[model samples]
Target: MQAKFLKSLMYEAQYKDYSPDFVMYDTLLEKNIPVVEFGSGTGRITLHLLEQGYRVFGIETDEDYQGFFLNKIKEKGFIDNFCYVTDITEVVEICNIIYPFNVLFHLNYQEVEVELNKLYKFRHCWSKLIIETDNIQYINSQSFRSKFNQNQDYFFKEFPRQSKSKIIIYNEVIEKNSLNIVLKFEYSLYLHKADDLNRIYNQIFPSAKLYGDFNLQFYRKNSPKLIAVCIK
Candidate 1:
């Protein structure tokens, strides 16, 4: 397979089937406020919302991921309901914002507070500011943090090197038949206390709430995920 096509293919296989966030996003949709999905990778949620008759403005810095989904949206005839830009600063409209999945892990609590303060003061619609991330505290508590998978066409592995405050995940994919390396991804995810995030966001939005998962349950120390929803 061609490199770009192969990467796109792998990306689809890795992410397409995960839909827990779908239910969460659906319940929060507002007709008049467009959803601006930060880190909207490959239109997973954007396309879903558009298909449900909601407008979406996707912000993604990765051009390859953006292009892959742009074509899909065009084919689905959802162009009128969606727009995309590479930078967050380029978004000018007020809308309900979502930092779905692990996108919030890219920033520490201080950084998140600073960014949310700026967003809340300027462009935030004040209806919602949804942020999601894995429970780094729980994840770090586990001894086995590595993962491996194999399929007919390719196999993938995740090797995480945890430090004091960040986890560096090294990922690689290999072709099955030829045993050749197909793609390698290295990423750093910052760790933050869920309570710290909740407190900081509460300062901005007095009604900020913390959930343990997509089901919107109260956060516990051992929960696998942390979801913070700030509503004014």
Candidate 2:
């Protein structure tokens, strides 16, 4: 699927509201100075950080999302507070915090190691790194409907039959008036278990802490999300 079209549908159908993850990060605002967010889709979290007076640099791989993010921030008069980078290595070396929100899961185990190693190389530059990911055990392959606006809704389904290491998600936007599918797209992502994540990070950065949710609580077996906070 094209990045622009997928993002437009996602933003309208599912990402219109602030996520609970946002609230969780908000609590740590004071500690997240001069932040850098990886895979910052359409400036959702990036805009919030900029509005709160933080100097944020976003690293987005998608050209469409980068353009959309720049336009939105510019309109909000926060253009100066934010910068864009297409590669992680291009980021300025003085940032204190790094946010890899749901980006790690997009990579396979080997790829994740490479990315983590890259971040580890800059361990001395950044004091803290926050990683958010879906809890593989908590998610089930199923179909559901989500209400977007009064006139439209999204039908979501997941297929995990391909392999244990990955899942394919299918999304369709339906118009209520005609009950017709207006938009459809599918995307795939690699899956990572909590134990695997913990083992990987602990090996690289021994002091990394793992939490079950955004509330900063200890990781439970059944938590919906996995969050890792690594301090240098």
Which residue pairs collide, candidate 1? none
lDDT by residue (1-232, candidate 1, tens digit) is 3355554556676777788888888876677777889888888888888878878888877777877887788888998888886645566766788888878777776777888877777644446778887766544345337877665587878788887778888888898888988788877777666667667767887777788877788888888778877776
Backbone clashes per model, in order? 0, 0
TM-score between model 1 and native: 0.84
The per-model lDDT (C-alpha) reads 0.76, 0.69
Single out the weakest 10-residue window by summed lDDT for candidate 2: 143-152
Taking every candidate in turn, the Cα RMSD to the unseen true structure, in Å, is: 2.7, 4.0
Candidate 2 local lDDT, 48-131, one digit each (tens): 777778888787776657777776777789998888776556765656454546788768899888888888986766767788
**Candidate 2 local accuracy as lDDT?**
0.69
